[model samples]
Target: MFRPLELFIGLRYTRAKRRNHFISFISLVSMAGIALGVTALIVVISVMNGFDNELRSRILGMVSHATIEGVRDSVKDWESALAKAEKNPHVLGAAPYIEREAMLQGQRVAGGLVRGILPGEEPKVAEIHNKMKSGKLTDLFPGGFGIVLGRELAYKLGVDVGEQVVVYAPEIRATPVGAVPRLKRFTVVGVFEIGMEEYDSGLAIVHMDDARRLYQTDGPDGIRLKLDDMFRAFTVARELAAELGGLYRVRDWMQGHANFFRAIAMEKRVMFMILSLIVAVAAFNLVSTLVMLVTDKQADIAILRTLGASPGTIMGVFMVQGVVVGVIGIAIGTLLGVVLALNLEAIVKFIETKTGLVFLSPDVYYISDLPSDMQWSDVGLIALLGFVFSLLATLYPAWRAARTEPAAALRYE
Candidate 1:
């Protein structure tokens, strides 16, 4: 259990009481700065990770991984397309859908995108069945003219389940007066909430047959496919399109939402680089602290050198001291960050409830609560970076201390 002389001396120097109280205060401040920086980086990164997961799961859950659309704007033979898509090993589920822009007039009027879905097959492709807030997806029936509205959309229209609404299709019919918009009255059979304002306030669903009748189409506009791995959606869609051939076009979720995720990624990187500056600044403080320490202990260093201590050993002593400070700060910060990240949702909720202040609104942010997903890998990386910065900061001051002229230093004494 023998320790290196340099390590022993470093530990003693770190623990020794300084005659200058300001130097000790600076040392404390440096440690606090590092701890603050590490904590911020961990918490922010974890929240970003949480947002990424939430966007992927909630958005992908409600939409298809890939879509096969007809070059003609309507897939006349969707059944065959569905069959072909399902035959692909990458595809986990496939469902036929017809989507169009429509206007709804209830207590109020609003415009939205309406999707036609089969009640039985819809659950396999989308999570609407599990996302119901008031009514069941089964409420949608052929020839019933029943429609499912998103919660926010329903709220905006002032309509609820079992209420009636008039739908105006984008298609125009020739009339005696002029071209009149095709319109129909429908019963609101179900309501759903997917926690995304864009989807919730701008989308509605109807039975496949009802949609076809309303749009005057014989079949679905396209087949939506769910893949085993969503990240591979683009590749799978391309391969499927090539396999199917002949006027079949493929689209993936990423194509539509690439910018959104890209923004998140870019913001995460910028925030990381920005927050890392805090650690860097604190590491620079360590250099200042060690330089002052070297100046204060010049006589001691000279005595040690005269007693046969090597310059390398002197450098090792200061390096060990700086590393000790960094390790302690990193450990404390990591523990605090993990605790905060793990319970971030609850903590935010509690704060909101107590202060009667809303951080996120369902109508604005799509999500109503803060989310956090701590990754040990991110924590490890932050800790390692802090250590490296601290070690680097120690080098110049330690080298200066190592190169001290013993004869000159003791001659002043």
Candidate 2:
């Protein structure tokens, strides 16, 4: 196989032993630094990607993509509203629901939101049925006055299935003496765990009829909708609102959780920039290594120049050498990062089991385990960035080597 003269010479220089071992050591250090930097970027970005995915699955799964509710208080004609929503091609399914904020008291007191859901239709709008930890969703019969509490909520209230708890509604009842808050005692028939601390600690479910009776409403509070594409919720909600017309309001999951997702996106961007600095620093090491190499190879450079080598070829030689170092580092780092990211969960679990140290606590982080989703796009971008920086770092030193005067360099010999 044939190779370019500059490339052959550059690669030869990379492997050659030098009188000063410090230069060789610095070159190795530069390669190692680049490798470490690339590895860190890959692992951290993958972890962030994993968190984003988990949030979408767990949070969105538990909430409706969009809701159509009465502007006044309750949707008296929710059936018609549901029908109209379902008529839209973008809507997957719709279910009626009643939501209220209440105080739950058992062994202790806790404040959270309560939702009235139809056991059969609930799965159409939310994934509560699939998340049940103990009892079945069907246990929440309309007239049975049964309720389902989230696992953390039940734990905090110190109650379990088959236990009774008191729920105080925010609505006030008019009495002969004065206005008083309405309260009801309910049997806990089921418990669910969504794995998100906020939802687990602040949500409860009951039959739709029980909610209507407890809140003194004639019909459902609103119609919850499931869309074909979650990202299209806002547009679909608006279209539904326009179609429904008259005192009908629309709300979507994005409206309620936009800030949270935005924060995650901002954090991801900031992290990418911050971590890129490490690769940048390592790239600077390439500059230092190449500078020292140029100084040590001045004699050979003069000989090559006298032997009819052009400045462009001399520049190509050093650039090839520096880029070779960067390419090797990037390849190793990418491989290590991918392996780590793919098995991050198992690795963390093993560490936790052996060390008995929990890195991500469900109570604090809303998740019990670390998640990792390696994106090849992210890996490719990181590699490209490192390569560009390494290539750039070679320029100044390579240019200096190219411009070296053979007359001046050979005078010292």
Candidate 3:
């Protein structure tokens, strides 16, 4: 019954008019500060998560999650290697590949790193085939001497489907006339785009048979595999590699993109730590507000003590008041954060269109657009931390209120 009354009294003192207008303004500002800081932090971290997801889908999606290659020049009994890898419980997909760095030149144009891939097996291992923008992955048939070009590489070479591109393998040798490059002519069969600049600018694909012929290999250079859970790709690769003996070696996506992914994770943590200071300051501001309220209500405190109110009860009153302010601000902030996180890309686009300024550019950033992904766990953690700090901030002020002496304060009055 008295709980509602206590609640009313608690809220009432929070907004009660006081001679110290500056202190009231500071309290209001502190609440707003927490709200803004939380919203901004949620939006930023969500966008970072979005970018991380984009990289996985657009970049990693096109690349192998794990690769099992022979430590020697080429993998022998490639069929056996493929079969053994597929038998693993964790392996979702597997494909044999002969990837070599070679220059592709058409007319006077040249592009780099012509990757030789098997059309049938590639689809099972990587999503690059699904991303073909023009023509078909099957167009790179072994019998046809055809190759697929990366979107940007296609643009740079100024070639399209049905055009001829010269592929210069590492067969260049010194001749009596001059330096000669071992080159072959292949028809461009298709163009693929994964929206990642690196792939588009530096990669090309050909039939694995064609690649083997170019490298003068009897079998595939290596085998690429995808796992049921990509997060476990590294562990699975390690176990499989060990099982297959020393002839085969394994490499996972984590090894290839370790530093980059680590940097993104590190940046996320650093940003959270820095932004949290803002929330900490806002939560701690309750101390000042409660202390000021206690000083203002000294006379009333003395009267309440005379009427036999315990020090504990007095402490509870101010403690509840401070907590109420913190709760209201955190609740509001969490709601705002959710809204911003869900539609962050749209908001950034609208702002950029209205102002004709790009906040993120494809040239500088990986993707052309903003991304946002909000985790409910992050919201809960932030709210819980704010509330805890708020409770901690109230102790000193609440104690000060509880320590008010009835006789001494009334005598002064």
Candidate 4:
């Protein structure tokens, strides 16, 4: 159907000056709409992708890739477990930890989780060292009873480094007078800000030995493991669980933060659907543009039909014109979207510097910068959707043009 004659006529119709200025204006508007919709989809999706990555990295910075815990209570043989886990090629590092709930009392009172760690081995599984705001991890000696507080947690308790906070353990002690809560005085040696409110507001770190003493645990509660590739966390957790002979249960980072990540994924999907409507509306606008073009070209259609051009060839001509318009819009939009997404951060920075206004503040948001991560797959899918919608929009107009009565159209001309 798309012979040289049909192709030449179709392209010529696309480029030729139109007698009806309204038709030309509508065509231009339709093309611009498609380009705007495609650009919006690309930029929004890329920004969402960036947020997903940034949040994941921040959460995993404190949470281990995977962990093994004793089914009943403390893992008494955590040293052996750590040694065994390190044998696996996928396991990059391992550390023993004890976790329990406790109340911290300073100028204020707040509840938090107390994590016990061996200062020297802690870096193997977590990023506490780099996150520290004051003092050092080494300050938490076996007998020093030193503690590290999360930035928000410290603020909640109205305490900072070099201050003392009394910790009330869950266990009760039998006093001569009556039962009382077992407690200890701990010196705040350091503070760390994880940026995430969940961790920064509710986690405290201490030496493994101090944790055991406070919690009355025989040993560390579990062994935390960091994998070479975090995406393999679940598989490695299962293998470690099996290697340990089922005496313990293993949990991966995904399981730990399942709800949070799931919410992000759901939001991404919803945004994609919502933005797709814009593209669909822009594409369907082609129908109006093509219908008007067909109306204006009745004389041209009659001339082609009288010259023995098949109906299919006439239909192909209109289809080609419509498609050319759509392709131009999609190409321009795709090029602009990719460039914007790639340099979005720098662009944001420039705007902020020039305006002296902050888009994201560290004090208000965990992430203080606009980020973008453009994936080729997303771009390809968006472009394909635009093309398909545009193609579908042309069918009715092309079919109507093909069915025009040559004699009647000639009479009107």
Model 2 off-target regions past 4 Å? 1-4, 176-178, 361-365
Worst 10 residues of 4 by lDDT: 1-10
Residue pairs with backbone overlap in model 4: none
Error of 2 at 56 (Å): 2.8
| Model 2, CA-based lDDT | 0.91
For each candidate in the order shown, give its overall lDDT on alpha carbons. 0.89, 0.91, 0.83, 0.92
Q: Would you list the clashing residue pairs of candidate 2?
A: none
Per-residue C-alpha lDDT of model 3 across residues 316-406, encoded as one tens digit per residue: 8888888888888787788899998998888889999899999879778757888787888887887787788778988999999999988
Regions of candidate 1 where Cα sits further than 4 Å from its true position: 2-5, 19-21, 174-179, 352-358, 361-365
Q: Over the stretch 1-413, how does candidate 2's per-residue lDDT look in tens digits?
A: 99999899999988889888998898889889899999999999999999999998898778899988888868887788888888889989899999999999999999999999888988988887888989999998878989999999999999999999999999899999999999899999999988888888999999999988888999998888999998889789888888878777888898888899999999999999999999989987999899999999999999999999999999999999999999988898888889999999999999999999999886577766788999999999999999998999999999999999999999979
Q: What is the clash tally of candidate 3? A: 0
Tens digits of per-residue lDDT for model 4 on 286-379?
Answer: 9999998998899989998999999999999999998898998999899999999999999999999999999998878989999899999999
Give the per-residue lDDT digits (tens) of candidate 1, residues 1-413: 89999999999999999898887887888888888889989999999999989987888878899898878768776777778889999889999999999999999999999899999998878888998998898888999999999998999999998899999999999999999999989999989988877888999999989999999988898888898998898899888778777687788998888899899899999999999998899877899888988888899999999999999999999888888888888888888888999999999999998999999986577777788999999999999988999899899989999999999999969
Off by over 4 Å in 3: 1-24, 107-111, 172-180, 352-357, 361-366
> Once all C-alphas are superposed, what RMSD does model 4 give against the true structure?
2.1
TM-score, cand. 4? 0.94
Clashing pairs in 3: none
| Top candidate (lDDT) | 4
